[model samples]
Target: MSQDPSTEVVARELRGNILLVMINNPPVNALGVAVRCGIVAAIDAADADPAVQAVLIIGTGRNFIAGADIREFGKPPLPPSLPDVCNRIEACSKPVVAAIHGAALGGGLEIALAAHYRLAATDVKLGLPEVQLGLMPGAGGTQRTPRLIGAKAALDLMLSGRHMGAEEAHALGLVDRLGHSNDILADGLAYTQELLATHAPVRRTRDAQALSDRQANRASIEAVRAETGKKSRGLFSPLKIVEAVEAALDKSFDEGLRIERELFLQCLDSAQRAGLIHAFFAEREVLKAPETRNTKPRAIAHVGVVGGGTMGAGIAVAVLDAGLSVTMIERDEAALARGHAHIEKVYNGLIAKGRMTTDAKAANLARFVGSTSYDALAPADIVIEAVFEDMAVKQAVFAELDRVCKPGAVLATNTSYLDIDVIAASISRPADVVGLHFFSPANIMKLLEIVVPAKVSADVVATAFELAKKLHKVPVRAGVCDGFIGNRILAAYRMAADYMMEDGASPYQIDQAVRDFGYPMGPFQVSDLAGGDIGWATRKRKAATRDPRARYVQIADRICERGWFGQKTGRGYYLYPEGARTGTPDPEIEAIIDAERARAGITPRSFTNEEIMRRYMAAMINEGANVVHQRIALRPLDVDVTFLYGYGFPRHRGGPMKYADTLGLPKVLADIREFAKEDPLFWQPSPLLVELVERGANFDSLNKSE
Candidate 1:
């Protein structure tokens, strides 16, 4: 082994006739400028050495190299760009072998592709995931990947940005050998020695014949373009990826490299790229809570779930999937049996769809037990009540949990919009009570709003975050409020849509406009999927407290009065015929909207899609600002993350707050003030928004201050 402090990022040592190059950048070995230069220097030294017959490359820590250094994003270009380094490695005179473990993604995978041969551990992951950041791989990945694998296969890997395991990569010819040893260096050295003994020639991927026949793959390439066009919607990178792949098949290697570079630069300069990068950072930032930063989380082995309805069964499944034993309690024997049946039906559906094996379902079910008695929860490390949303029901459940749960057991409530503080106070051990608001279909949704009450301890908050991590969920800390962050904001924007419907715009038009903004479904479409009865119940609960002077749209209530409760009833805003999941526009909804507008003594005015989106976004941003101002949310990014995960906020626009920041705060404030002229009650600008605009700052400034 050789030691050199100057080139510590990329260390080198010679083993027999093999030159071993190890990238020593810690924490995933991100390819920064220093690491890129070091790799180039190491390869140059190996090529110049007379005794070296083969070169082996690997990473020092847990990962080979995850991707480019995100810290370098939006900065000035540095010398020896990644493309230059990759080309240098590919042009080496001696045979080069790359031994990868952990994740070799984006530029890391691009560098590996430049090598003559690739070997990986059985547990390794390899991918070109740059498209997720709104950019395709720039460093010859577009040109070289299709040459190793066909254009269709390369497009599938690049466009989806999904990581492929070693077994799959080996099947696809990306990896030549799989090592079973944990000692990657030893395995790499052995592979290198075998290659030297066999006298393997320096095979360049640039010379591969995988993509030489452009005529043969033209149909496949066009099909990819059409599919990506629909799937990507407002995204700019997926189409660029298609163009680059087409270049690989139709043009020479250098020509394709030129086109790829052009397309990559276009993606880098796009607004979508900036938004996606913000989203990527914001997701990581929401986890850094000041209260939980240094606190030690309590260990949880067994969990107790109260309730066995849809939400309860989903929660139990999520817990059991995380390898925790769960005891689910219901009100009676029949209810408990139904809950057990609901959970079993879920797994059986998965098994039927080939998503789960029979043995896996049996093992998961083994961790789950159903009972009607609260006494079974005595051994639980934590207890979560997923019962009815009513205050009385939640309080009674918590009281029972307080009586039966072991001391120090954390008590949590899965209330979406109730006052969690009151619930905590209802319990004997208020300090151990927290609110864990899991979105609908809890096992599938990523967002878990961790509502911390006034008396909860810091360690309990830390434990909630730890639990979220175990369940593969994103946790955002929220203070007690009527709707917390996501639902609070959701309530505001949903009202705005209702107002728009009464004014003139149809629900279908509003949905199409929001869809054009890149959401998978608009607000009404979401209501249909989730069932409108859920919203109807919430409205009925809040009807007594609603301000008399505020504008109320009764069109939705009119629909629900007829028992048209959305997908469940085959009718809501749109009609679902014959139990179909999708719904078409219904003329009856137009009549209800017109009747509501006439009854309110208001004249309807036509609204352009552009105006509709502006009003909708303004409403969302105004409430998001209030969420931060009231301290219901820790930071602006928390609000962003909640919407991004819970609701279908377009990730390419960042979260709503990030999108507001991209649009200047002053502009957003001006829009709110203008809209206030028509309805001052609903369009009132948030004090935080006004303060931010007056001080010439933005939501991101609040995130930084925190």
Candidate 2:
């Protein structure tokens, strides 16, 4: 309205009947103070102009409004907050519509709710996704959306904050129509003209009630509390969301709105909100380094996997599923046949789950080439080595690949906890050697820890990131070290769990504690699932390399040695429990721990779940600090991303390091010091944590250094 750079709204008069208003913020058209002020002025202009009978608010580029800038959240809500802005829009006498495109999310959807009518572009998405950041929709979304859709529908939207396409949204009554951007505008304008001719806008989304019964809404609240309590467990956002939705059901529209606002404010001020938002922003920033985005990169037409083990087979399936032709090499035809059979078994199971159609399975299988020859990699743009986790064997594979691969082909090692520098030492083009550590079932998990050793050229790092994007995975640019980032922290965390077992906690008890803390599975169950043999080997390797630096629990080793490997062995931490789906903690494991503790003259003491969670987490956070201190990670946020996306740290808790911030860095430091005094071997704090605590700083502050 002031005609300033940020204040001016890009408006076009539409055929003397409608004014198409576009918010002109570049990149994502975020609803900032300037944009909100401009919109308020635009509504005033529309009322004053004789030619503009109707108004349609739209966006200029890929999205209508992705959301308010995250930078603006957690700060005080700017005066005339999003709710107030939407109220102004709703109060306008002229018919107003929202022509949404891209992602109309958070505050963006709240603005659209203010309009009397709505139309979204075909490909655009809509969601009230503040819950992901530990906040709910603050700007009247809780009030108006239930009025537009049902209370049940609104609860789902508010609680999960999941994205819905325009088509799905139309079916759900969240949108009035779905079409192309211009078509959506035309439809919205025509609808507005009909309203004008009829004397007033007829359909306001604010009047639709969500749930049928008062008791039913209360029941819904109870249901969500149980669900989120089990699902989120340690996290706080979902439970708060349940309360906000209950407010919607129990109170009047204005009263419900007041409650929603109160809850949103509470969450905004909470450390969880700040932590989750930090992680949210850091994840988007990970793929946006100068080396990844600024350089010219080649397209990946073909890929090669130089192994036929479970890891290699999974990697090949992911590549083929991404519509890239893949050739997998094995030691012989028998191994190739075995790997191909494994792939078939996985695909068949997927088809059974309705996740993959027969046609999709056929296509993916068709794209896979299984062979035992070096010539299979002739056309590969990139080659990933998913061989065994042995240094000498990996060196041999790389030596062979060096002779086989094209001059510029990107070569990567999918090694967990191995030295990438040592792997590259055998290669001619060390610049081209990067580590692409994919978690098992590479196609399913989103985390791809991209290890960029110091010797890796900027272009190679860029190419690794570009390839990760093509594979549709989260690429974390981790510096080279043992286990990179995810497994490195995992190593320490598991050590804590083992330490607990050595003290009085049983395997099931530790599992219960971890799952209670929001991890999907407990460490012992995970170790069993990951093969008890793997942990046994890593322990021996670390033990052989260094003196017993920690209170090493030898119980898991005994289980492995007994060939009670895990779920695969069906007798590791817990027994199969006879025809039961999952195993329970073996009495034998407890007995084993007792025997080991007695043998070492160790006094076994009881540990509460809180202490188990504390020590387990302390080990992880301390290890994360060590990782950062050793330059094995790019930033503290990188450690967060590694855990959140890659290692199943609850998104609501953000990541382990972010969660530590909520726990207070000084408190965590104190706990570590207490443990160090108890046993200086395993409980010693990393220098980074010690310095941060000495400086009265947090991991959030360390993230700033990046």
Candidate 3:
């Protein structure tokens, strides 16, 4: 074995006529500067050595190469760039083999494409997922992938940023062969030796004939371009990917590479790239809560879910999907049967969609136990209360759990707005109580707010995070507050929209502006879809404490009072005829709004879409700043992740906090102050926002500090 003198990351050893080059970077073996240089040096050594007839490249750890080293993001350019390294490998006189195991993504997959042949382990995952980070593959990935797999498949892989398993990759011609052994090195050596014995000729992806049919390639490119335009509306990279793939068909191989590199640079320089990179890092950072630092999560095998409503059944399904056994308790046999039916309905839908087989559904259902009695939950490792959103009702559920659950079992609440600290205080095991605020459609939504009360133990918090990972959910640690991070900020921003509606803007106009700003739907649309009665109930609950002097919008209340509780009843701020999913503009709603404005003795004014977004974003950012300052959220990124995963905040803009940073804190504060001039009570600028602007700092700085 010989280590390259320049860098130790790459090592080479001669095995008969084959030279094995191993990348020794730990973890995912991200392609850093040293690794790039080392690979070039090793390739050089193999080409010069007489004993080495073929070179086999493989990583030593779990992954072949996950991607670029994220630590080097936004840093100065390093020597022997990934593009150069890929060209070196492709230019080697000797045949090169890449043995892919685990994840071979982004630049890593690009390097594999540059090799003469590719062998992947059965469990290997391959993709060019740079589009997720607001980048198309820079180092020949765009130029070569289409040549290897054709334009449609390559564009699909890059655009979706989804991992293709080994079988799928082999079928798509992305992988030359699939290994049957557990040891990647052994599989690679055998494959390389077989290639040498056969005297196989060098195969470069650039020289492939996949793009020989120019007309077909153009057709595929245009199809993808149309689809991308519709789906990736505000995104910058997906369209560039289509353009680069088009270049591969229209330009020469070398020229195509040049175009790819140029487009990649453009994507890298885009503000969307900055926002996406921040979101990428923020997701990983949000999981690192102070409580989870040294503390170990408790072992959770059997989960108990209280109630049999939609949220409860969803939680049960999520737990079952995570491979945990669930014991569900309902108040009565009819409700228990409904919960079971709900669980089965999900599997039945999956079955109908061909995503799940009958056997798989049966297997998952076998682990689920449902009963009307609470005694059935005695053996549960954790009991999650998903009852009504009332303190007294939640207290009753916890009191039962405290009496029946096994010692050390985690007690969690799925309350959306109730005070969890009060619920914890009412129970005997206050230390075991933690809030696991799963969003509606709990099994589907990615966000899980792990609300930590004052009395909850660190281990319990850690356990909640662990549970989140098990359920394939993004966990954001939240200090106890009325609505926690996402909902609290949501309430503030939704109020801003309501204020706009009552002042001059129509709900339809505000919703359209919000959608134009990248949210999937506006606050009013969301309220309607979620059933307007839900928010109406919350309003009535807080009505007694509502400030008398503050402006109030009674339009929603009036709509609900007439039994038109949104889509369920087919009427809201918008009309949904015959239970249609999309609502239409309602003349009655307009009349109601005009009457309300007259009742409040306020004159109506028109708002431009841009003007509407300014106030809406100002409200969200100001509340997000306060959330971080009050430690309801540990950092700004936590708030970002919460909204990104939960509230349909556009991933391209990052989250509310990240959007604020990109928009410039001073401008956001200015907007807030300007709005405050009209309604100081509603637009009270967050002190943290004001402080950050005074210091010329941004939310990102606070993220770095935490």
Candidate 4:
């Protein structure tokens, strides 16, 4: 063990021929800057010792360095890059072996590749997932991986970002051997001794004479270019990965790494990386901003859930799965019984699948207790009001929870768009009221947006973040505002879609445009699936309470007025014959759009799908800038996470806001200003965006300041 906790690296000389090196950093063994330095120093120590004939590198805890400390990303990369470390390791005369047990990701995988040989524990999984985070592996991954695994295999691994288990890795020739630890030091020592005896003269993978096959065929390179052309349509980096691979195949080892670094630097300069890094930081930052840090929290072991609707049932199921005892409270016998039956059916379905054993299913269900009274809930640790989204009714529920619940009990409301501060004002203990916005099918979706009202205590924020960790969900902190960050950004973008509809674009055309741009669905289709009436209800609420210019959409209201309700009503954008869910666009709506355009004496010109996509994305980025200016969301990544997880953003495209970085700020501002000429109030460029554009910056540069 090292002399200090801050810098810990396990080291020992074994039997005069084996040098055992282990990373002993506690808590996930994060490869922080200090750990990196320690590792470099350890390698120096191993090299200087004449007694050391072989070195074994392994991690002490669950696994090796999970990845580089993501916190350090964008904040100037540390010296002694993983590739440099790997180069030093391989160039050593003594054979180096990597003992990988759990995960060897990003830098971890890079380190393993640096070693002359690698042995794996049977359950370990490995991969290079930097592409997912808008990064290609910087440390010789593009070069060395292809050297070990062929070009085709390496390209798929880099592009698809799929991970493999130990056995699969062995089958693919990534791992030299797979075994369990019979005796910790003994196993690694034994492996090292066997390697030392072979005198195999550690073959540097970079020195391989040939592919043992031929170079990539012409058709293969063309196919890769075409695939990248489609996949990274607007972005520059994924295709750049293909370029790096091509360089790897054509150049010498040193030459290939130089090409890899060149490509890596190019990606580092990209807006996609900036946007993605923004999103990555936002998810982490939201956990402890001052919104709910001081509020006294109740012990959340037991929760009383009110409402038995879809939201209620889902909340109940999630709370139970989190190992909290749930007393599901409903209005009457029918609702109570229905809620119980629904929870049972969900658990039963899980049992039917091989996912959950019958015994485990029963045990999980036993944690749930359904009742029809507020009397028993008064003593519960928490009471969550997952009722319908009506302010007066929600206020009444808050009043009831305030009256019925014990002191210090957390009073939460699961309202998607209502102001959490206003909901908190309804109760005397306003600090106790916070927003817990769980996406539908809560257990399946990983995002849990925790919104803090203006007067919320710091302790509450910490508790919420901690609770998110316990639930195994990513908790993003949001400040009090209408719809918080996610929906507020959507409000502007969704409204833009409606305006585009009136401005000579069809609903189907807009939907197709968005889907082509990489969103899972178009705004209109989402409105239909989410139900037009809900938008109508939210609009009516805004109309009654807020200013006329409080960012509202009315075209959908007119559609709802005609009873063109989505899905459940079986007639929405398109007609749903008999039992179909998604309907075709109704021709009548085109007539309504035409009539509205003529009534307003507006010129309607045909727009190509390209213009529609550019406008929609521009609107979303504009709103994201507005939200950041308003300080509703901490950073750009928070907005990215909001859209990516909540709104079904194409993961590979890296969410809308991050995707915008690829479009460049100046171009987006130009487009927004052009749109503003058409609709002054709606299309006015965000001041934040104007400044960013003026500064020739992307979201990433601004985020560094945050």
Q: Evaluate model 2: give its TM-score.
A: 0.93
lDDT of 4 by residue, 1-706 (tens): 1334444654444566777787776655667777777667667766787877778888887886677776677677777676777788778777888888777888888888888888888757688877777779888888888777777777778877778788887887887887766444566677777877777577676765334454453345557778878866666677888888777777788998998998989998876676566566666655545544565444578888888877788888877888888888888989999988878777888878877788876787888887787776876777778888988989988887888888878777888988888888878998777788887776667788888788776666666666667677877777788888788888877778877777778889999988886776788788777788988888877776666664443567677898888877777776777858767878887777788777666687788999988888888899888888888877776787778778877665556666777777888899988887867888888998888877788886655666
lDDT of 1 by residue, 1-706 (tens): 4545667899888888888898988899999988988888888888888988889999988999999998899999898999999999999999999999999999999999999999999878889998888999999999998898888889999999999999888888888899979988888889888888888899999988887677767877999999999888889999999999998888899999999999999999999998899889989999998778889988899999999999999999899889999999999999999999988988898899999899998999999888888999999988999998899999999889989989889999999999988998987789999989999898889999999999998888898999999999999999898899999999999999999998889999999999998788989989988878888999999999999989888888999899988898898999999998989999998998889889988799999999999999999999999999999998999999998999989998999999999988898899999999999999999999999988888899888888
Error of 1 at 134 (Å): 0.6
lDDT value for model 1: 0.91
List candidate 1 stretches off by more than 4 Å: 1-5
Residue pairs whose backbone atoms clash in candidate 3: none
Model-by-model lDDT, in order?
0.91, 0.81, 0.91, 0.77
* Per-prediction tally of clashes: 0, 7, 0, 13
TM-score of each: 0.98, 0.93, 0.99, 0.82
Q: Which structure is stronger by TM-score: 1 or 2?
A: 1
Q: Name the runs in model 4 displaced over 4 angstroms.
A: 1-15, 22-50, 60-63, 69-81, 121-125, 138-173, 176-186, 194-269, 291-298, 341-360, 544-554, 575-583, 634-637, 649-676, 684-706
| 185: Cα error in model 4, Å | 3.6
Model 3: residues with Cα > 4 Å off, grouped in runs: none
State each model's C-alpha RMSD to the native.
1.3, 2.6, 1.1, 4.9
Report residue 273 deviation for candidate 1 (angstroms): 0.7
Put down candidate 2 lDDT per residue, 1-706, tens digits, no spaces.
2344557644444556777788878788898887888788788778888777788898877888889976675577676578888888887777888878888998999999888888888877889988888888888887787666766777788778899887788988888877644555566666666667887653455566555566766776687788778766666667777777777767776788788888888888777787678788889877765567678766688899988888888888778878888888899989989889878888898989999999988988888887798777877888999988889989998888888889888889999988999888777889889899999888778889888876887888888887788788888888777778888788878877877777777778888888887789888777777788997888887876666554666787778889987777677887765544488766777788889989778898888899888898999999999998987886788889988887778776778888888899898988998888878888888999989888888888877776
Model 3: per-residue Cα lDDT over 375-494, one tens digit each: 999999999999988888888888899889999999999999888899999978899999999998999999999999999999999999999999999999998887999889988988
Minimum summed lDDT over a 10-residue window in model 3 is located at: 1-10
